[model samples]
Target: MSPEEKPGGPPPPPPQAGRCRGARPQQQQQQPRRGGLLSEIRTAIRSEPFHLRYRLSPGRELGRGKFAVVKKCIQKDTEKEFAAKFMRKRRKGQDCRMEIIHEIAVLELAQCNPWVINLHEVYETATEMILVLEYAAGGEIFDQCVAEREEAFKEKDVKRLMKQILEGVSFLHRNNVVHLDLKPQNILLTSKSPLGDIKIVDFGLSRIMKSSEELREIMGTPEYVAPEILSYDPISTATDMWSIGVLAYVMLTGISPFLGDDKQETFLNISQMNVSYSGEDFDLISESAVDFIKTLLVKKPEDRATAEECLQHPWLEQSDEPISRAWNESAGGESSDVTQQDADSASEKSVDAEKTEEDESIVTEELIVVASYTLGQCRQSEKEKATEQKAISKRFKFEEPLLQEIPGEFIY
Candidate 1:
């Protein structure tokens, strides 16, 4: 199922046809009989035709969304693999090409950041715009969250991934861009068996935050959204920090901090700041990890730690000795006076062996089953809530100013 659609959620409202307010006479005359407006919009955007440079693989869909579908594609000349994200030019009888264009522009601006996904090029057709993006073979980090206990990320692993995520967020904040959405699904890994570097993807909801203006919008996956978002308050970089806190909690415990039985309940939980760190959910988690989450999950946005601050938190700075020693104790291994560096190297070697064993034991079918169960348990409610949230967003009429023209530097 598409991320936008939940198993039991209501279908999206149908489109209501409408006419554009302004159009040049000559352009209207040149418009074709069908999909004319979209064609003109595509021309103005100036993208190369997708079919000319790349060939999409049949039955190789990467993902799907309300107005977009991602498929695996290969560049003809270089035979390089890429994920082609085809976004519809129009949605619900309104021109949404600009939103796709905005995402492209954000990607362009973030091209220099190693943590962010690289956009190779763009392509356009009458009805769709395609983004050629770097492909991450390891898939979503969400998978690891749902993996078996033995295969799930340990404290040390989560620290490494969280640091990278923070680095990416810091880079975006430095660029004055706020990635409103920052959940596990959007964070991809380059490799899976031994894990790999982070590649942050899905910038469709991201916005350029200007200091002179307060950007406020009710758009994000419900479970990971900040309290300010629920209150319809001004959004800041702290909003993303709130999500990072929730993400860290989920990564460590595989349980959402504020999720409830339903959308209304979820919102209420967030509004009231209802959360728990007791019981078996956090039994194996470290106090420093819990403290790290607490520091960011504060009700007040300003009180939350900034991305840079989060990088320097004690939880992230904790050396490998404690975790390694704990692991040794748990596994009934003998303790020795090993140096921190030696401990980390031993821990890495041990984790790698475990990973290899786990990879060999877990079959693809079991993974699919685990993934399906995890999605049903964790993401179904999130998807249902997200669909309703999108509908509620329409009532706000939160429109961003359309860009007059694509910047020359941003053009691919």
Candidate 2:
């Protein structure tokens, strides 16, 4: 059964053909929401928009974060299933509400994008803000890397997924929004299908630039942050391209181009632009992929390719055979053949992870989780609020203030 049918709302108009395109399977007619786990969620969402409560029953908990928990949820209304994310208030001293608002605002800004996660709705109670969202059950690309262990993604699959991601990033850049944080964990799969349709999520660190110039915000994951951003130089859509380069590296090699056992080591390697590629791993990758990554990870942000430019790179333009040979025989290893100036710049990146740590934008944490919500909670709250508003209007009255039209009484 479809969730709309079960929610007992009017049959949902078919999703815009271009937007959904057979994304979800059609199901039988669903009965409306009865008293069940879904019903309980609806009540909890209504009472307090924070602190999500759910009954996963048989399904195990996939993961948990400081602010949200992802559990399997099935829609009783339509018998459709989803991953319900329960988001709670931030721990004491954390401004969770504000963070949720930022994420919602960013998602709303990117709502029409197919490559980005779609937020269904948002409602709030005194304690929590319920956000019902379209679930991406296929999970994160990070999981894909973990599963591969040492072997990276198949090159063809990497290109297919990269094309989709490029489209998504292109859409974001067109809107002047720079996703400051771009990593595997944030890229989600709508389905575990062969094509690997992706949806970009988590906008807690996004920035909307006002012009074509570099921005001066110190933000982004260390492994992917551009050197210019670290120097407080400036950032733009190009900064995101740098991260994409790193992403491409991971997709093709299974290991990050610049990795360290600890943050300091990672920062040191990134600062020096120190990177390596095993002969076997390099053989498995294509020249175009390697070239594309090299072009973006350049020390000079200006020289680094922009997302749009990357789409037109010769690597992306070549056939698989030719591209594969470039990596196996031509492109130089840890020592790139870019230029003397670029080499010099890479050598002098002020490997100062210490200074970076002191920057206010640096948040030394494994993960930062914010608001989450279930569809049931949002629907139930709207119903309850409507009912309360009706009763309040009928019973409440307001006395108007007494008129004081008399001129300032001099001697009245």
lDDT of 2 by residue, 207-283 (tens): 55654344476656667777776677777778888889888886665455665544566668778888765444566
lDDT of 1 at 395: 15
Clashes of 2: 9
Query: Which stretches of model 2 miss by more than 4 angstroms?
Result: 1-58, 89-92, 149-152, 212-217, 319-412
The alpha-carbon RMSD values of the candidates against the true structure, listed in the order shown, are 14.5, 21.5
Clashes within 3 Å, all models in order = 0, 9
lDDT of each prediction vs. the true structure? 0.64, 0.53
* Most lDDT-accurate candidate: 1
How does residue 306 of candidate 1 score in lDDT?
A: 92
Error of 1 at 326 (Å): 10
lDDT of 1 by residue, 1-412 (tens): 1222222334221110111124222223112112111122212443667778889988846765656777888889999988888887877777877667667656655555667888777777889888889998887787776554445667787899898899878766765668887877788898888889888888777776655667667767677789998888998899999999988987776566676545576778788988887754455568888899999999999899998888889989878534521223355322222223445555576777875664453322211222211231221111123344432221111112112221111111
Model 1, position 63: C-alpha lDDT score = 64
Q: If scored against the real structure, what TM-score would every candidate get?
A: 0.70, 0.62
- Predicted structure 1: lDDT: 0.64
